[model samples]
Target: MGAEQIRRWESGALAHAVTDPFGQGPLPWLRGSEHYVDATGQVVPWYAEPDRDRGARGPRTADDVHRQIKGFAASGAVAPGQAIDFHITVDPPQQFSVDIYRIGHYAGAGAFKIITSPRLAGIVQPAPLAADRTVSCHHWWLSWRLQVPSHWAVGAHVAVLTTADGYRSHIPFTVRDDRPADLLLVLPDITWQAYNLYPEDGRTGASFYHAWDDNGRLLGERDAAVTVSFDRPYAGAGLPLHVGHAYDFIRWAERYGYDIAYADARDLHAGRVDATRYRGLVFPGHDEYWSVPMRRTVESARDQGTSLVFLSANSLYWQVELGPSPSGVPDRLLSCRKRRGPGKASLWREIDRAEQQLLGIQYAGQVPEPHPLVVRNAEHWLWEATGAGEGDELTGLVAGEADRYFPRTALPEHRRRILLAHSPYRDGSGALRHQETSLYRAPSGALVFASGTFAWSPALDRPGHVDSRIQRATANLLDRICKRD
Candidate 1:
């Protein structure tokens, strides 16, 4: 927007505030992962990281501390079978017992218990929430270890630690496994923690995009936390991005009885999954942050015949590193500097390693409104049982941020790239743009498919938003990819 347009917007905002001081009037807002899809469709965009000179570095720590929870609670981020070295933080501290539960499919219906620890002893103290740390780091008065069961399913799990008085918080972890299978499903744990504004006070911590200053001014790139730990719980929706965008794919694939193994984003970074052993690797929703080792491992897997499927947009946009926490455990703190700074600056595209090279499409722009996912190549095998045809549109599928082919280079290098959907939409600014869904074969004969939209997986089961075509199309990809065909 031009200076004149920005001034007009500011004037309108001021006028609205004057008329409706309480903010009860109707107003629209732009939501989620939307950004510049420049005219050249640059693989690594100029705006991937905030411009170096754009924002000032705020004070390194908060002015005041948020010492809120005055009740009993326990929490930690330890893998299955590993000890949590749990902590109980409360004023005049209270004793509590811990009950661990595996969140996904269990014996009957919901979560199944893994372990129940003996009632632990503790005392509370004044632990100021650390701004740079992005957590209270409540010192454990009575440090106790709670171990997860080894036989439990390898997926998302939460240990709901509570006191007899009902004060509680859900500590989450992934029971990472190395078993080889037809498919390897990766959970985007790092991204969830990256965006979480746990305490929500803005003093202690916030995600990369929404950090605040002493005067409550929104800081840009400088606001990004260099180190974020997984010791605390996810606030509000409890993994909103994962649940809304990735969980459905797990349910759908499992319901259909596919042999799938699970790994956290950290597992990929650590080279835990022998990617070559699996026929396919599935990355569900909003996987924007990644490390260099992770990128190399996946690309190597792709070169060695492991089919790759990204059921989301904005795949591998930022480069990040996994470091240890106050505890010497790797992957405890996600480290990223989304700026042209001294450390490993996170935006991968800005460093010239464009995500388009991996996923075959670059994140184009955000389209706030719901629109059809129009079919371009109806006869493609991916559309096998979807009953979609040329010109047919899958209503309400093109979601917030979208991916499109740059059209300037051959991403797959050797095979014919199949463009499926050429759906168009009006961006948040009312500018015209489009999202593309595509599939192609790599030089190693490995297949690669991208949904080009973040909403693709969630649309599988969401009410009204659910589309059979989308589900069928996904099922088609899984069956073929898993078979290593």
Candidate 2:
């Protein structure tokens, strides 16, 4: 059967009638055995479905993110007046301290911070796991009551977490002294097209799935490297599921602005969403796959001053669409069969236009082996503050073991484009391979910061403090684009 058929089957398109139509009550779940062992190991034939929908049990694994969130809600039995409690369980559980601050604009003071929780607390070291344990779980939890005084202008706040290694992570939450509306995060969902395999299933294996490179074993037949949750299609009605890279970016965006929102590209491709609402559009890490509508909407949004940031390299490579399906959500959305054959509009063309107007630099193509090291150009803005000019110092982050550049050219006539940064790109010293990252400004004044390197913000993951330069550079870009024309 085709993907469409699978969706229809999952959606109950073909239902079977029950023989006991005269049943006076709800039917019991059929079990082969007449009796069963209960949770307590006693002989109990049946018990309620373990009201898991409520605060049924504590989290057991890292996959309990959803359950932990539920336990904090009234429906989950967090007493009416009790504070909201949430927990994040991870493997190799580590301890960390997080401080929540209230950030907002009061009159003309601009953005200011007010300590909201735990009071002037210092570094909080988390409880360590058992010493004997080798492979267990770590659970980090934060619980607090909502109490914000009146007269505080509404805005967003940051939950700055500091790990033992001195690495700091930011989680954003909003504080409204008025009615609360859900904060929307617009994520470019690309979990379906997870791997970059040449022959589609080059690394495919049976028995068990191993997430190559990371060794973060997925541990299941359904656990494809895909980060976006696809356990059962449309399980959430395509409710803007964030995954992998997009999750990190959205978390970052929330700390800066609470108005950010996202929808799956497939949803947009299927015409199930309206993308014009957001004031800014963010294309996070390695968004190489793009349906026709995804490209068109983003392109249109950029022209209308919807600030676009392509925080990635080799983006928009594949051309996909909302495939034929009957499920509530779109199926077969991303359709770029790399080695399967080639045809139709290439992402190269899209990059060409984008470089001419918005983000500068058409993705020439992926660089081959023997990665070249990046050498700063005189025009690169990042070098101004570092005082590390050409041949003086090398960049901190490297791409693909070495740096790679996109194949680029000058923007079209009258197109004011700028090359922000570039690295020495050549084909293996033997082949004729050539690529470079060129930043440019469009005719409408939209700015693009292209850094042929894919590892643009690797410093963000450092285990203690955020790189001040990286933060400043990113913040500066946002400030520049959000300015009133």
Candidate 1 is scored at a TM of 0.77
Best by TM-score: 1
Off by over 4 Å in 1: 1-81, 88-92, 95-99, 105-144, 215-222, 237-243, 340-345
Top candidate, metric lDDT: 1
lDDT of 2 by residue, 1-485 (tens): 22222232222111101111111111011111124444554453221233334433221211111211111111111111333332322223344444454332233222244543442222222322222111111232433344444544443344443333333333333332213222223344442233311111112211111221123122232332221212111111111111223433443444565454334445445544444444445555555566667667766655654545666555665554444322333352234433323554434454344432334554554343324334446445544454444544233432422212333544432245445444544333454444354545545555545544444433332223124444555555655555521
* Model 1 C-alpha lDDT per residue in residues 1-485, reported as the tens digit of each score: 22112232222122222211212111001111124433344332211332225332211111112221222223323345765455545433466566666543332233456677787664555453565746635443545655656766676565545454434444555666677789888887777667654444434445554555665343444665666666554543123224445555665666677788878777778876788889999987778888888889999999998999998887888788777766574566677777636765466666777788888888887767767888998988889878899989888778767899987744656477788999998887898899999898998988899899867876764434567888888888888887634
Worst 10 residues of 1 by lDDT: 24-33
Collision count of model 2: 14
Residue 22's lDDT in candidate 2: 13
Model 1: how far is 183 from its true place, Å?
1.0
**C-alpha TM-scores of all predictions:** 0.77, 0.47
